[model samples]
Target: MSFSSFDRKKENSPQPSQWKLLRQELLKYLECFLMAVINGCQVSAPPNRTAAMWEDFITCLKHQDLVSSAALETQSCYLLTKTAVSRPLFLILDDNFYYQSMRYEVYQLARKYSLGFCQLFLDCSLETCLQRNGQRPQALPAETIHLMEGKIEKPNPEKNAWEHNSLIIPSTTCSSEASLKLTDLLLTALENPVTYIEDNVEQKKADRIICSTNVLHQADQMLRRIVSQTMKEAKDEQVLPFNLKLLAEELNKLKAEFLEDLKHGNKKYLCSQETVHIPDIISFFHYEKDNIVRKYFSKPH
Candidate 1:
């Protein structure tokens, strides 16, 4: 019988078998996923120095909040532009913070003056954030003066040496991926053994968060690539850096403690390479193609 034959006023009218076959075909593409485990949860800044920065920056903002929005915008503008600000003002925002606003503000300010390269580093920040503001570095600690040059897709060995330095936004996120970034001995040394062990438990759970997280990251990357590619092919000036970077930032957004642990390098995760057997999606859903629509109502989305 045709689907139109269903009785009038019947929301649960029988569905055509063809509709079920189409529905099952759609589910196949949605199941594939990827995953990675991690260990450690270290922040770029040492705990002591980071705490101090938090205290001081909050105090600075408190004064601005006391004034009206119009007045504050004037002050924020002066701080952002007019005054000859010193090199490298670190703006730290946690995963919970909506930092796209910060990015837009910085991008706008950069337009007026050649601010060198504009960069957003996830997982890591510049080294100076940990250093005392006035004291000179002992032996000129390595600085972020240039981009990690070379091909965008291939590995570049000379990345550490490129000169003609300008704006280096060194981020801990782009460095050593997977287990490499987490569990630095420096951070482990700072931890009290008992609390450290407890943190490890939550970290495992994070690593276990269903493949949904990875799916979201992959979707975002795919969208970014399509966007970047479309823009670049037409010679557009502004093409966003997509892929690992876009994925990295979203990964940091997972509210799960494991993600936080992975971001800051607190909880250590075991990383072992393994092969996968994707679900028998097609066969499983197509058990009986003739009556597929019946299965659609019986099964879940």
Candidate 2:
């Protein structure tokens, strides 16, 4: 019943530009699936490599052109469509997701849709990660592991109020106690979907930007920081060594694009208040970076 055989790591995962679309379609599919479960559909056993009760769900996604016809025949598709005989459905997204912005994207989705959101941080020591990596048939470069060690941003619940539902456990811990705690975590998340909370920090940032004498200078500085942070995040996520140069080129390209849009007064890039918001541009830059990552590199090296 394990989905290990058909995880997203082996598939052409969604690109950044498609992320919003994917999230919307997934929400729709979840609603259909929940309705089906409530209607007492003939659910399959352990839901392993079967999609008998998921026709409606699959059709819903297919009609949106999210999954191709060929993809439907794959084990990954079946795994995605598989359902539990319970009320709540959990769709697990497994990845390195090294950047906070990357994880924040998912958090925003959960908040917007009022879905459950929780983070499980596996605090595996660098030594352990390197050891296990060495044992693998296709071990990643030691340097890559070292790079990730320095770049990984552990869950900081205190710093981030929204991350209050996070749990951190040692990677090696596999006791019944851990399992029970995990079960509780999931239950708690399912019971309490994330609610929209005003971000005072963001509000303050916007106010400062608005009142600044040199708004363009402030924006340029922020954009530079965004680029620098994005490059670091890319490295932290262990982008394939061969694609690092391409990733950089792509990021710079996006920066130029944004600069042009800002300079020439692109209406789409302008806010309703008739002023350019650096945060919006930065967010769009991250989205572009995600697209570049998915297009150039499937997974971390």
lDDT of 1 by residue, 70-185 (tens): 34432231122211122232222222112223233323232223232123233232344334323643332234111222102221123311111212333433455433433332
* TM-score of candidate 1 on Cα atoms, chains taken together: 0.17
**Candidate 2 to truth, TM:** 0.47
Count of backbone collisions in candidate 1: 14
Stretches off by above 4 angstroms in model 1 are 1-105, 112-117, 120-294, 298-301
Give the lowest summed-lDDT range of ten residues in model 2: 1-10
Error at 71, model 1, angstroms: 13
lDDT: worst 10-residue window of model 1: 29-38
Reference-based lDDT, each prediction: 0.28, 0.62
Error of 2 at 64 (Å): 20
lDDT per residue, candidate 2, 1-301, as tens digits?
1111122232355555665454444444454444434454532223432243245445544454333455335543322233344457675555565655556666766776677888888889999999999999868789989998987877777756667788889999999999998999899999999876658785354344334424554666777787787678778877777787887888788777777766556645555546556677667666766777687656532
